[model samples]
Target chain A: MKKIFFSFVMSFVAPMLFSQSYKPVQVNFKPMFGSQELVLNDSVYTFNLKDSVYIETLKFYISGIELLCKNKMVWKENNSYHLINLSEENTLHLMLQVPKNIHFEHIKFYLGIDSGMNTSGAQGGDLDPTKGMFWTWQSGYINFKLEGKSNACATRKHEFMLHLGGYLYPYNTIQTIVLPMPAKTSAIIVIDIKTFLSAIDLSKQHHIMSPGNNAFLLSQIVAKSFSPWIAPSKK
Target chain B: MDSTFQKISIIFFLLVLLTAFVWVEETAFKIPDNWPKPKYDFTKNPLSENKIELGRILFYDPILSKDSSISCSSCHLQYTAFTHMDHALSHGIGDSMGTRNAPALMNLAWHSNFMWDGAINHLDVQSLAPISHPDEMGENIVSVVYKLNRNKKYRHLFAASYHLSSITGEQVLKSISQFMLTLVSSHSKYDSVMRKQSLFTNQEKNGYALFQKNCSSCHTEPLFSNFQFVNNGLALDPDLRDYGRMKISGDAKDSLKFKIPSLRNIEFSSPYMHDGRFKTLNQVLNHYTKGIQKNNTLAKELETPIILSANEKVDLIAFLITLTDRQFLFNPAYGFPK
Candidate 1:
């Protein structure tokens, strides 16, 4: 009787204790500027806008992805704004999981932080300023971003950066994208750089560092391009 | 048998005492009467005296800096109206100069947003600006948190304030907000005059009227600011090329707009505007009367231009002095923690 009782306790307690450890996953993001999609190692595309433009850096934030199981919300990160530093190409990965109990039909989530969190004070994880996705002057998170110089542009290889962020009226630029993570035990979200830059018109507007019309429009276009991945059910 | 009943009663009383302790720890914040409702939603993080004190210490401590050289008090000195008067632009760690003037921090509970550009939406997270800015504290939140966690004093303070063994970023921000919220500046001479306890001189009364006509539209009453971003017709600096609210709002109509500052304690906070262009009250009045810029988004009230005479300008200056609050300036609670 004692041996049987001990077995029952171990069976229930063992799984509960071992199930909570987090396993990190890498998310591969790719960018395509202009018609020609720029490759990761391709001799940095020397594209000129007007003056001597040299693309120095591009950074932005991605937040609030919900893990789904069989079309039900399994779990979601409370605060999830990811800083994408293209300078370090391989530092992209979103850690998420589909619970064992439910069979996940797909995964769904927003691309940028919600309005509530943006107005709310500083947060931990990717939302933290150590990530460099926050603005120092007007205190809000930069939801989407693109920075670099264009030689063709009027401002000589002057560093042009667009720090896109604004959740309030007239300047709200928080873009939303829902990608389908198909029913799989393990999967990697491959983000191709070529796909993103193909739609964005860098020459017409090269520098947008704050929340405004340009930032909002560009963020919308980026969200639209994400459609190919977000709606993979048809693909 | 009587001993058994007595022991049961004692155990029940101990349980009740423990419940009462938890109840007090989780008590909600109550808005003080006769004060404007707070813009911040206190339901998120309830107030406690312990948390407010911890935030006060952190606000005054330079440990939030990369080199422990500057604290929030470095720019926001308690005296001189919580403003640094010597320099136009706020100079930070290693003698780095920030782009804009560090506005005086007070009555933050009523401010919908913070900074000259309305950049920071919430008070809890405002510290991140100075903390991470290369020209400011030059410290990252994670590193600062780690440093605070390592320090025995901060750890004890956090434990006392939050009833936790470790301090989290949320606790740190919330505690700081508590302290900043307590910085009430409603006891100024102007407030007293309004309350009918004190009287303003003829010069001050005339100045107040001129201010009402020329400045009160943007710099409203009581708090002395509408808290809205406006262009105020100040010409953009060629070197800085700041577009103010236009940069944040992205609206072409908002070009060159900036937040209208409070007139309270305006006498001491000279070199005003976002860039600290005006050196004196006379210069500021001169701009109002003759220096109105022809921006497309200029306020309609200032379209015709405010025509204040030399003597009227002096009266306006006198009224501004009434806003100087001696009590607030010397409040020991807002002084350095030491």
Candidate 2:
């Protein structure tokens, strides 16, 4: 009779214990140029004051993700580096494991690759050298890439290329972004590219291939463009 | 009971022997006596015999190039102290030319930066520059990996080296780095004299003293290079107009600055300077004495004329020759894989 009672208790207790440990949370990144959702390679979006600019490629790295509750650390992702390529639809969603029953108020992440990973030698996956995000002339990785056509640009095809990255002092381009999370389980982070490129005049300074003051200023603008939106069901 | 005990003892002894063999292999990469600690962090990519051999093969293979006509060895020959002997500037595939001269390859594990411009900060990714340069190999790393995957021999080599079934760009770069790390040139006649194993001639001794006074500040001891970018006051060439480190940093103060090449194997690595403007040691010495063009960013040491008699110049050249390590230049271990 004692053994039978113990088995009944174990069956109920095991699942409860498992459920309390951790839960998988899906974080979706939705790229937007203003209110219009971006459809990669299909959507023709216009930006800048005159709305004569359009982007052909926009890709960047987001890393060092951490969850906070009341300014206290709750959970952090391991090897959290991710490359968000708008052209590839599957890369938009990221799965994160968070502690169960914890109220996460904010999500913090980096806009570019961290300095630690930059110095470390060739890595696999999204950080691989073959990803075309690496610089051949220099040893550092290109943190962010924005290439597109702009009528303001006087160059051939009216195109501009901005590849930003530098880890060293006085020119560090890494930007930290923090978004308030209303829902603990899941949220959609919106990146508005139009707002990010509002300040720059493409005609005067169309190309920024290496890291410097221009890259740092641009990355700062990008960091401010992300905002979290909670779905009604999750709220 | 006795038979069982004997079997257990034999098994234990075999295990001990196997462990020792593994330990020996892991500790094969040695640090030379009195040398500074290596800048390369070896924990990330552990050294092994198989990886080094694979790297040597890759170093000599022209398959890394676009048309399979140029290899790393084309510019870096073993006999000329791993530098192109005749060319003022490095020539690439299709007879295309590069802006700067190809620097010598030796004691690279100690370097914190690569290239004449100091553009590359690490050795592992240094090969990517030449491989992707339009005038150089003109091959992308992705295509290189694809080509390496299709080749049967590389497939076998990658498997043997990395114990993986497929080839990767990371593995290819790391293996090449392992081979380069083995190139530690600490057996020169100067090294022998420092170790008390040999004595320098009177001419060499005099030159050594002269070198200590004039050049040692930039071309530091032991490594023979300070490895810092400085403006040595070479006038800009109208055709090339290469600004060196300033091009990378965009700082006007760093204009015309270039990495100081190591004086080791100075006898063979000519023409000299970033542009290889001087074909002889005499020309380099003459420039130091008279050809220093005054500029805002010129090295302060070279501001005043370097005073040296004709005999003193010959003595300095003799001392520089002592830095040539015959063992390193002709080491079969570093030569083409047979």
- Displacement of the residue B226 alpha carbon in candidate 1, Å: 0.5
lDDT of 2 by residue, A1-235 (tens): 3444577799999788768788888888988878778665565667754656677787889899999888877889999999988888888888887768777888888988987888777777888888888888777878888888778889998888988888777788898988887776777999887777776777876898887888887777777888875334753
Off by over 4 Å in 2: A1-20, A48-54, A230-235, B1-27
Per-prediction TM-score? 0.74, 0.91
Per-model DockQ against the true two-chain complex: 0.28, 0.35
Compared with the true structure, model 1 gives a TM-score of 0.74
Q: Residue A113 lDDT in model 2?
A: 92
* Candidate 1 C-alpha lDDT tens digits along B144-245: 888989999999988887677887776777888888887878877788887888999999999899888888888888788889887788887999898887
True contacts kept of each: 0.55, 0.61
